[model samples]
Target: MSWLVTGGAGYIGSHVVRAFIEQGITPIVVDDLSSGHREFVPDGVDFVEGQVQDTSLLERTMREHDVEGVMHIAGYKYAGVSVARPLHTYSQNVQGTAAVLEAMQRVGVSRIVFSSSAAVYGTPDVDLVTEDQPTAPESPYGQSKLIGEWLLADQARALELTDGATPLQHVSLRYFNVVGSGTDEVYDTSPHNLFPLVIEALIEGRTPRINGTDYPTPDGTCVRDYVHVADLATSHVAAATAMAEGRELRPVYNLGSGDGLSVREIMDAMQRGTGHTFEPVIGERRPGDPARIVANGDAAARDLDWRMRHSIDDMVTSAWQARTAHPDISE
Candidate 1:
């Protein structure tokens, strides 16, 4: 029995793939390679080059690999850019999720773990975001992820209504800012993520810029919860194992650090970790950026063995080492 990981060629998905292997579970990867690197997929793993939106491809892959569950991580994940590309975001996230669900139903696979986002709680009023927090997404990307969660719920409900049908055992993991690296083999390569952006600037002998320094925070910049990618990947494995063992789980869990770090503080850490001492260029706040958004991971810790295994320095140093190790892939 194997689990199919959508977008397993990408940064986060690739780490999850390795985590599954370490736990003695087989993983089949399906990726379109739009933003993922083929080399990121380890050797000997079954990989299908295709979009998750293609139901036939997903169904065929599931049957071919004897897939018992799915870790759906493929989506247009840029929240800020989604403001200008709502249709693209919805098509990739919402429609893609629908296709995955359809394929699962066709193959009689009843388990899924969706990669959701904290953007679902747009500028949450509460200081510490919880699973019970009301969702008010600000960007199209956030809305699309929220809709993806809805699709899972709706599909499970429909299955429940069917007689003699196995109920869907599913969970959605809402991630905040996922940083750091699980292994030098696979690191965060996204041009949009903060860690890579800053690392790229340092490597190119350029000063990184911090957008919006006048926010209502101690550092006057947007504060966000950051979690190590390796720690995050472990939780995915935990969730999958829990479902396979018939353990009950909440519909949603936030894989977040209970605290936050401002963009300026991140810059400081970057300088110390990368040995590039330069003041960041202050820029105007990008539209739709929340001042601060941290989350409580108590539920995930209890159910999914979640915890902050790495410090900010660990996140920075590991990311730097991994990125610098792959000069050919660095942009």
Candidate 2:
């Protein structure tokens, strides 16, 4: 059976799609090409260039592709932007998710792997945030994601109570700070994350900007767990397989490297990775960003058997390789 990947042409979405293809699954993609690049879409998969909020487009794509499962990853994903423009974030993350669910109900798609975020946890008091952590999102972006997951879980439970052939089964994978270059066919150039931005500053003979230096951390910098994109892709595949093999399970798992690293540590490691030295200038902290954000991956490991292998050095080195080789992101 085929799968549907909303925002399948985006950086993270493209990697997940390629991961599915590697497993011999040709997923049909729905994207508006807003932040997603058309070139990132692999050759075999059907790429429907349209908005996820468009019900007609979603229904048509699902029906035409005979989609069995949906890997939903379409949404605006910038904390600061969401803080600046809450309405836009709500429209894309919340409304877009609702639109996809409506289309699935219309076309009879049974399962979905909703892409949630660690932002939902905001500034948890604990060092590592667990799946059961109380959601207190600081930004509108995080709030939108948390609300979307709630929407999916409630819908699933409501459907399960009814007598139906295939109840809507959904799995929400909340992740943070994804890093790594995708396959040769898929690469991230203009990444908003630190990995690509650091690489960009290195190649340009400029120091990477450190958002804060006064936070209560080892180096007074914000700390975060960076999981490899490939590992995340594998986790998505596992989520799909779990829902398929197991009778019924609607759960949420946090996908992240349990080990936390501070921004200063990351910059230092990156300098070592690329054999380059550049100062990391400390600046005013970006609003809504907490001092530290790390995921508690125990739930995902127990439930999905997911594990992250790539180290920070690997992430830095690989991203540098990609950026240096293809500075223009041409093919």
Across residues 192-237, which tens digit of lDDT does each residue of candidate 1 receive? 7889999998888888999898988997999999999999999999
The lDDT of model 1 is 0.93
Clash pairs (backbone) in predicted model 2:
none
Best by TM-score: 1
Angstrom error of the Cα, residue 194, model 1: value is 0.8
Candidate 2: Cα lDDT at 262: 90
Cα displacement (angstroms), candidate 1, residue 158, comes to 0.4
Per-residue error for 51 in candidate 2, Å, reads: 0.8
TM-score of predicted model 2? 0.95
lDDT score for candidate 2 against the true structure:
0.84
lDDT of 1 at 266: 96
- Give lDDT per model, in order: 0.93, 0.84
List model 2 lDDT by residue over 1-331, tens digit each.
Answer: 7899998998889988888888777788999999998888887678999988898899998998888989999999988767889999999999999998888888888899999999999898998888888999999999999999988987777778867635888999998888877564555654567787787777777888888899988889989988888888888988887887864554788987888999899889988999988888888988778788888888788777688878788877766666676656432
lDDT score at residue 36, model 1, on the 0-100 scale: 91
